[model samples]
Target: MRFFISVFIILTSIAPAWSDETRLDYSGRTVIYHSDVKLRGSQKRDVRYSHKANFFGAVAINTTKKTNDSNGAAWGYHNLKTAQDNAMRSCRFKADRPEDCVLYLSVVPKGFDFKPKTRTLSNDAVEAYNFLVGWSRLNFDSYRSFAVNGIHTWAYSASAPTREAAEKEALEVCEETFARSQKKKDPAWAKAVYLKEHLQCRIFVTFSPV
Candidate 1:
C-alpha cells in the first residue's frame, strides 16, 4: 500500500531547541523561528523581502554565535526540498562549523498544510522517518525511496537516478533488515517484536526532483 508522508517529522531529539521557537506568523501564511543570535539590518531586510516575494522558501542560519552573520535564504523555488538545500548551502558557505547551520524557517503558500500519514509510530520510527526525509532533501536531483513495516522497522535506499531502482532497493533493504532482526537469539525482545508485528515492508515515501 502506498503511504504519503509529509514533512513535519518530529525533530525534538535530533536537533537542539532554538532560543526562539517556531511559531506561525501574524499573517498566518508564514512559519518562522529565529535563533538567539540577532540578525543585522541587511539580513532583516533580506528575510522580509524573501518572505513577501516567494510562495515557498526557506531560511537557514548558523546558531552557534551571538552575532550570526552567517545566514542563507532561498526563495521562488519549485519545492521545499530545493529551497532548503539551497538555503543550507548558502549558510554553510560562511559558517565556521558547517554542522552548526540549522533550518531557521520555512515559508509555504497560504493554503498549504502538512498532513502526516500516521502518528502511532514509535519514537525510533519517527526519528527514522525524519532521517529519511532529511537525506532525501540533501540532493534535489536524485530519486530516493523509503520503506517501512508499519512499525519501528524501516529502511531507505540511497539516492538513485531512477524512481523504480530506488523503490526496489528500499524494499529489499527493509525486508532484509526485518528478516535479519527476526533471527537474533541474543535479544529476547527482538524475537518477541518479530512475532507480534511481522509486517511486510511497503513503500512509505518517494522523493523526486522538482
Candidate 2:
C-alpha cells in the first residue's frame, strides 16, 4: 500500500507541471496565439536558424525614413508590438515535445517588412521558427480587433499586384497597430505626423544574437 501511495504521489507531482508544458502544445505543435487574429497570403511560413545566445524571439517595428529622395525614407513603417499575456498561461515558451526550448511570443509590429537576409543561423532556431510562423500567420488570417485604450485595431487581407495597393493595405494595418503605442502614450499624434507605410511585411523570428 505504501509503495502504491508513493507512486501515486510521484505521478501527481509530475503530472501538473508536465500538463503545464503541454499547455501551449496540442498534438505535436506549439500554440502561440489565442483563437483570434486573421492571416492571409500564400500563408506558408518558414523558420530561420539563430546562433550563440538563448534569445527566444525579438519584437521589431519597421521604421520608414527612407522615402524622400532628400531624406531617403525607404525602409518602411515604424511601430511597436504588444507583449504576451503569460500569467494566465502555462509557460513562457510554447509547450512541445522537446519541453526545454523557449519560444518568443513575438509581437510583430505592423508594416515591418520581414525580408529575409543571408545571415548566420542555428539548428534549434530553425526548428523553433518552423513551428512558430505556422501559428502566427494563422492568428494573422483570423485576427481579432484588439481594442487598446479605446483605439480598436483590425487586420485586412492584403490587396495585391500593385505597390500602391500594398501601401494602402499596409497603412491601414499600421495605423491601427500604431494606435496601440499611441494609446500607451495617452493618444497623442498630430495629423502632421509622418506615417511610414510598408508595402511588404516579412517577419523573421529566428534564433540569433542581434
Best by TM-score: 1
The RMSD (Cα, Å) of candidate 1 is: 15.1
Q: What is the TM-score of candidate 1?
A: 0.40
Clashes of each: 0, 23
lDDT of 1 by residue, 1-210 (tens): 233333221010012336545455556665555455566545565467645642556677666542435566655433445456556666665677778777776666555455643423333444666876787677778888877764335677757789998899888887776566446323543332222333577887888875
Q: Native-vs-model 1 lDDT? A: 0.57
lDDT of each: 0.57, 0.23
TM-score of each predicted structure versus truth: 0.40, 0.20
At residue 163, give the lDDT of candidate 2.
Answer: 40
TM-score of 2: 0.20
